[model samples]
Target: MAIEAQAPPPSATGPAVWLRKHFFATWYDTVFSLVFAVLIYLALKAFIGWAFVDAIWRVENKDLCTHDAGACWAVIESRGRLILFGLYPYEEQWRSTLACLAVIITIALSCLPSFWSIRRLPILWIAGFATFVLLMRGGFAGLELVTSEQWGGLSLTIFIFSAVFVIGMPLAVLFALARRSSLPVIAKSFGFFIDIVRSLPLLALLFAAAVVVPLLVPDWLQGNKLMRVVIAFAIFFAAYQAEIIRAGLQSISQGQEEAVAALGMPYWSLVIDILLPQAFRNTLPSTINQAVITFKETSIVTIIGFFEVMASGNAAIGSGEWGNQYVEVYVFLALIYFVFVFGLSRYGAWLETRMRLGHA
Candidate 1:
C-alpha cells in the first residue's frame, strides 16, 4: 500500500503569529518579554498616577502643592509664561508668541517640496526671519522698541537656530568648495581654518565672542551681544557642516564630474545644478542631524547670559514659591524640546523617503 504525502503547513500571518515569532520564539524569549512587558506596564502606571491622577492644574496657586504627593504641575500653570517668554515683558508677550509662530511656520514651509528651490527658500526665509525680528524688536509701525537684550526664551532660541542655519549653510558650502580648491594654498588655508574652529570648544568661542571681542573691537563695530553670539555659533556650525558637505562632495563618482565638465556648463551651474544637489542628497541625514544639534545647542546661549528656554525654565523654578516642583518644570521643558526635535527628526525621515522615491 502506498501512502499519499501530506501537504506542508500553511504559511502563518496576523498578530498572533507575529507575536509568537518575535516575542515568544523560545522559552527564554517569552520569559524575557513577559518581564519587560510587566516592567513597562508598571512604569506607565506610575507615570499616569503622578502626571494625571494626583496632579494639580489650577493656575497661579502654589498652596495646593504643599500637601500633594503627585506632580505639582501648578508650578507650570503659574509660571508658564516665564518659561515660554523669559525676560520679555509680560504685556508684549503677544509679540513673542507671534514671533515664535513665525519661525515655526517658516520652518514648516521650508520643509515642503514647493519651497525647496534656492530662490524660493531664500525669499521665504528672508520674509520669515524679517517678520520674526519685526515682531520681536517692534521699533516701527507705532510698536514700542524692544531691544535684542530683551529678546529671550523660546523666540530667542528659534531665532538663534534659524539664523545660525541660514548663515552657516552658505558659509559651509563656501568653506567646502574652498577646501577642495585646485590651488594647494587655498585648500590648505581653509582646511587649517576649519580644523582650528573645530578644535576649539563652542563655549570658549562664545565666551570670546561675548567677553573678549568687546575689548578688541571698536565701540562702533561691537553690535548687539546677541548678534555677536549668533555669528560665533554660526562659524562653529559652519566648520562641522563644511566637513559634512565636503564628505558628500567627495562621495560623488569622478566620472560624474568629468561628464558634467565635458558638457561645458559654467562652474556655478556645475556646482549649483550638477554637484551640490547630489552632495546634499547624499548627506541629507547628516545635515538634518546637524540642524537638530544646532537647535539644541542654542540652550548653550544661557551660559553666556542669554535667557533661552532652558534659562527660562530655571527662572520658573528659582522663585522659591514653586521651588519644590523642579521635576515638573524640567519635564515641561523636556516636552517643549521633544516637540521641536521630534518634529525635525520626522521631517528628516520624510525627506529621506521622498528622495529615495525620487519625488525630491
Candidate 2:
C-alpha cells in the first residue's frame, strides 16, 4: 500500500499565497481584487503628494502657498498659540500650559495599575484635580484670578473630559447595580431613571443644564454654568454606560453567582469580589468606547457658550488675517484630539492584556 501524504501547516503560507487563497481563488474575485488595489494605490498616492511633497511648513513662506496644491501647514505655525489657549491673556498663557500638562500627567498616572486601589486612586485624583482648579482658577498664593468664563481652548476641554469621566464612572456602576437589584420597586425605578436620561439628546440636556436649570433653581442651589454642564454630561454618560455594564452582568453565568453564594459569601462580597470585576473585564471595550464618545462630545459644549478646543480653533481662523486658513486650523485641532483619543485606546488595550494575565 502507498503511504498517505500529509498537508503542510497553515503557517507555511506566505502573504502572496494567503491573498491568492482569499481574493483570487475565482475569476470574479481576481477582477474585484485588482480594481480595489488600483483605486487604493491612486488615492494613497494623491494624498501623500498633496500632504507632504507640496505642503508648506514655514510661516515666512505662507504667502507663496497656492490653491493648486499642498496643505497650508504655515497657518498652524502662525496661529497655533491662539488655538491652544483661546482668549487667555497672553501673559497668563504659561499657567494654562502648566495646568494642561498637569491634567495630562494626572490622566496618565491614573491609568497605571499601581494607582487602581480605591484609596490611592481617590487621593491621586483629588490632588490632581485640586492642582488643576487652583492653577486655572487662581486666587490663592497671590496668583492672578482666572474665572471659568475665561477658561477656553485645550485647558477647558481637558477639564470637562476629566470631570465627566471621574464623576460618570462611579455613577454608572451604581446605576448598573441598582438596575439589577433583587427588589422589584428599586430595580424598576432605577431602570426608568436611566431610560429617561438616555432618551434625551445630549445637546438638549447640556442646554437645559447651562440655561434652563438656573432659571428654575434657587440662587443658592445653582452652581457655575460650567459645573452644571459637567453634571449634565456626567448623567448622560452614566445612562449609556449603565446599559453596557448591565449587559456585561447578564453575560455572566448564573452558576458563578450560585457558587459564590454556596461558599457563604455575602451579597456585597459576591457582587464586588466576583461579579463586578468580571463584568467590568467583559465590558472593558464598551467602557472605552463610551469614554471616546464622551471626549469628542466635549466639543459640543462650545455650542452652549463654553470655549473648548473646537471653539478655540474657530477663533484661530475667524481672525481677519487668517480667515482663509480654517482648514489648517482644523487639521491642527484634529491632531490634538487624536493624541488624547489614541492614548486612551492604547491604555484600554493595556488594561485588557493585564486582566487576561490575572493582574487586574
Candidate 3:
C-alpha cells in the first residue's frame, strides 16, 4: 500500500486560529496559558500603578514619600548626580560623562563586524581606553588632575569591565594554548595555575588585591588599588575564560588540524586563520554569556571600597534624608543594569543568528 503525503498543515494565519491552535491546543495547555496570561496582566497593572500613578517625582516631596503607598522617585531627582557620578568632583563630572560615552561608543563600534580584525580592535580599544583614562585622570591639556581613588559610579564600572575584557581575552587564548601544549611541564603547570585561580572566590581575590597586596609588594610594584583590582579581575576572568576556549578547541576534529599541518603551514597562520577562529565561533554563545556575567560582576567591586553603580545607588539612598527611598534607588540601579545586560543579550542573539545563517 503506497501512502500519499498530505499537504502541509495550514498556517495559523488568523488570530482566532492562532489562539485556538496554540493556547487551547489541549485542556492542560489552555488552563496553563490562561493562568499565565492573567498573572502577567495583574503584574503589569500593579507595577504601572505603583511606578507611575502614585509615584512622587518632586525633590521637595521627599517628606511625603514614606506616607505615600507608591514609589518615591524624588530620591532620584535629588541624588541623581551622586548615583551617576559618585564622588567625582561635581565640577569635573562632565569629563567622567564624556569618558563613559567614549567607552560606550568604542564598545558599540567594536561589536560591528567591520572592526572585527585583530589590528583594528586593538587600535580601537587603545584609543578608547586612552581617552577614558585621560578624561578621568586628566592632568593633561589643562584638565584638572583627579586621582583614581575618587573615581566612582557608572564611569568606574565601565572602565573596569572594558579593561578586564580587553586584557583578559588575549590572556584567555594564551592560557588555553598553554594548557594544551605538547610539553608535559608547560601543560601541567598552566593547568595547575588555572585550577588554583578558579578554585578561589572572586571576592577573596579582589580583597587580597586591594588590601593585602599593598602591604606585601614594594611601593613601586604595588601600583594603585584600582589597578591592582583590575589586574586581579583580569586574571580571574582569564582563568575561567581559558577553559571555555579550551572546550571550543576540543570541539574541533583531529582531521582539521592534521589537514592544515599536512601543508606545512606556519603555526601562527594555523592558529590565526584556522584554529582560533573556529574555536571562538564554536564557543560564541559561552563567550558572550561569560562577558555578560563579567559585566554584572563589576558590582562586586563595591565590597572592596570601589563605588560602581550599585554602590553609588546605595550612597544615593544612604543619607538620613532620603533613606526611606531605597526601593526607588534600587529600581533605578536595576534599570541601569538591565539596559546594559539586555543590550549584551540582544547582541549575542544577533551574533548567533548571523553565524547560524552563515552571514557572519
Candidate 4:
C-alpha cells in the first residue's frame, strides 16, 4: 500500500488550461469558439486592409480613390482644419486654436488628483474658462473680436459642455439639498420644479431659450441667444442630475447625520464635510454617465444653427470635392467623440477603483 502511493496526474495550466475550460471543454463549445474566431479574424482583416493597407492617405490624387476599394482618408487630410475650427475667420483661427487649447488644458488639469479639492477646482475652472472666453471673444487686449455666432466646430462643442457642467453641477447640489430640506413647502416646491423640467423635451427647452425668451424679456435683458441657450441647457441638466444626487443622499444612513449633528458640527460642515463627499462618491457612475450624455447632446444645438463639431463635420463633406467621402469624414468624427468619451469611461473606472480602496 505504501509503495502504491503516488502523486496526482499533472493538471493542464496557463493558456492551454484557459482555452480548454473556456473554448474547448465540449464539442459544441469548440465549434462555437472556432466560428467566432474565424468571424473576428475576417472582420479585423477587412478593417486593416480598408483603413491602412489600401487606403488613400495623401491629400493629392483624391480622384484615384474613387475607384479604389478602400477608405478615402485624403478628404480628412484636406478638410481637417475646416472640420475642427468651422467658419472662424481663417486669419484669426490661431486665437480659436489657443482658446481650445486653454480649455483642454483646464480639463486636463482638473483631472489631476491635486486639483480635486473644492477651492482649487473652482479657482482653476474660473481662471481657465475666463481665459477661454477672453481669447475667443477678444474685444480687448488688441486681439481681434470674434462673436459667439462665429464660434463653431470642436471649440464650440467643448465650451457648451463645460459651461453646462460648471453651471449645472452647483445648481444640482442646491436642488438636491432643497428637495431634501425639512421645510415641506421648500422641499415640495423644488421637487415639483425638478419634475416639471425633467418632463419637458430638451429640444423644446432649447428652442424656448433661443426664441420665445427673447420676446418675453425686456430688450436690455434679452442677452445673447447663445448665453440663453446655455442657461436653459444647464437648468435641464441640473433637473436630472439633482435626482441622481438625491438618490445618493438617501443612501446615506440616518445615524451618520445624527452622529455628525451630535458632535456639534455646523449644518454646513455636516453636509460639506460628511454627507456630500459620500453622496458624490456613491453616485460617481451616474454622474459620469450624465456628463457623457450631456456631451453628446450638445450636438443637438446644431438644430438651432449653432455649428458644433458634428455640424462642422457635416460641413466638411458638404462641398463638391468631398461629397463622396462622407464615410471617411464620419469615421474621423467618431474618433473625436471616442477620444473624449473613452477618456471619461477610463476616468470613471479609475475613480471606482480608487474609491473601493478607501473607506466604505
Best by lDDT: 3
Clashing pairs in 1: none
lDDT of 2 by residue, 1-360 (tens): 998998877765789988889999999999999999999999999878877888988989888777875888888887787778877777888989998888888898998888888799889889888888888888888889998898989999998999899999889989999999999999999999999999999999999999999899999999999999999999999999999999999999999999998999998888788888899999999999999999999999998988788998998888787787777777788899999999899989998998999953
Candidate 3: segments with Cα more than 4 A from true spot: 2-12
lDDT per residue for candidate 4 within 1-360, as digits (tens), equals 368878998786899888799999999999999999999999999999999888989887676787565998999889998888888878888888898999889988998888989799999999989998898899987988889998988999999999999899999999999999999999999999999999999999999999899889999998898999999999999999999999999999999999987999999998898989899999999999999999999999988889899999999999988899998899999999999988988998898888878865
Q: What is the lDDT of candidate 4?
A: 0.92
C-alpha lDDT (0 to 100) for residue 257 of candidate 4:
93
* Per-model C-alpha RMSD: 2.6, 2.7, 1.7, 2.8
Best by TM-score: 3
TM-score, cand. 2: 0.90
User: What TM-score would you give candidate 4 relative to the actual structure?
Assistant: 0.94
| TM-score per candidate | 0.96, 0.90, 0.96, 0.94
lDDT per residue for candidate 1 within 130-198, as digits (tens), equals 999899999888888998888888889888999999999999999999999999999999999999999
Stretches of candidate 4 above 4 Å error?
A: 1-12
Clash total of candidate 3 = 0
